[model samples]
Target: MAFKHKSTLLILTAGVFSCTPAWAASVSVVGLFKDKAIVSIDGGRPRTLSVGQTVQGVKLVAADSGSASFDVDGKRRTLGMGQSFAGGAQPGARQSVSLTADARGHFAAAGSLNGYPMTFLVDTGATSIAISAAEAKRIGLDYKAGEVTGVGTAAGVVPAWRVKFNTVKVGGITVSQVDGMVVETGLSVPLLGMSFLNRMEMRRDGQTMTLTQRY
Candidate 1:
């Protein structure tokens, strides 16, 4: 079973890790259909569930092609197929967001930067959150005036701006004053890296990665 305190064996290449297990108590959206779904709890096993069915502390309130609505610990949560919900809670409780890998086994999360909608590719190896210069401008960020730096990319080294974000959010979790980098070249997708991940308790089981707030 995956948990926060245990360190799973991870292979590192060029100081970067891939498909490694990271963060939480686990819950998964195994299958999603027009109005039905299958979910699992704690990675123990998979079970087929339907609307209004409660299994392993998760109550499937509703299900559709794009999402599954669940009630956990008296709070309602909705997760897309393949995503997990281990850290589902209200504002006062432990907050978290769980993501499942796509066919390529890469974890991508739907969230926002400074309240503007954006997609984030979860990259644990990165030292800080990284965004493209275009994205920073789209989100009205003044990263151009931030600290100048150099960042290595697949193409080559490029000029980058180190900036602190006012807010970064995923699902119900929000983190503020997040240190990040705005690469002037060669980045299309923003990376959700250590600057944000380090603040959460993380765990993984198979293709699912869960992040829970440390506090």
Candidate 2:
């Protein structure tokens, strides 16, 4: 028993001593409302995060001035107000990024909104951006997953459910915590509703799409 205890102590000591400089530390930040910022880590090690990059297991500390930072391998990388760290790396940092595609106007891009992969079909006629029953189910939505509720359609009352999106981004525009609806009437297509379109400047022409927004 004494030998076992000594071995356990040694193992614990190694664990504590082996904490890597790359292991991120706890970070704190102050952010301003309506302000935005970008951050880099590990002295910007990877150099840059390209467009449409998915990131998790990362940290972002926001401040009142729209600046933020995260810990990298036991170090803190702070950002300034209105600064951009989205596409490029800083000195001695690991690469991180947000997934943003560049499609404008009435175009389609596959993305994970609300933590689910979906094909967004740009539509101006949709009252709000909408989704099909099949696509909604993949994102853990309750089409058949929950009790059906009433939804009004051009035909009449149809069944629908209130849904939530964990993340929503299009052409560099993003919003979170948005309330959405899942409809079941044999919708062959997932409609890109206004809930997303109202957030951007979309211009469409013959076979071309243009989208513009302020980052």
Question: What RMSD does each model have against the real structure?
Answer: 10.2, 19.7
Badly placed stretches (over 4 Å) of model 1 are 1-88
The TM-scores of all predictions, comma-separated, are 0.60, 0.44
Tens digits of per-residue lDDT for model 1, 1-215: 00011111222122122221122234578799866787655433356778878754567898888998887766788899889865535446777666777665667766668866566777887778888898888878898898887877766677888899998876556789988888887776678888899999888889888888774
So what's the TM-score on candidate 1? 0.60
| Model number with the top lDDT | 1
Best by TM-score: 1
Superposed by TM-score, candidate 2 places the C-alpha of residue 5 at a distance from the truth, in angstroms, of 69
Off by over 4 Å in 2: 1-106, 142-149, 152-156
Per-residue CA lDDT of candidate 2, range 1-215, in tens?
00000010111111111111122322222233332333222122121222223123344443334455543433446556434332222455442212222323224533346644344555555555566576776766654644456555554555776666667644234457655666765455556566665665555555545544322
Model 2 TM-score, all chains together: 0.44
> What is the alpha-carbon lDDT of model 2 when measured against the actual structure?
0.42
Measured with C-alpha atoms, the lDDT of residue 170 in candidate 2 is 44
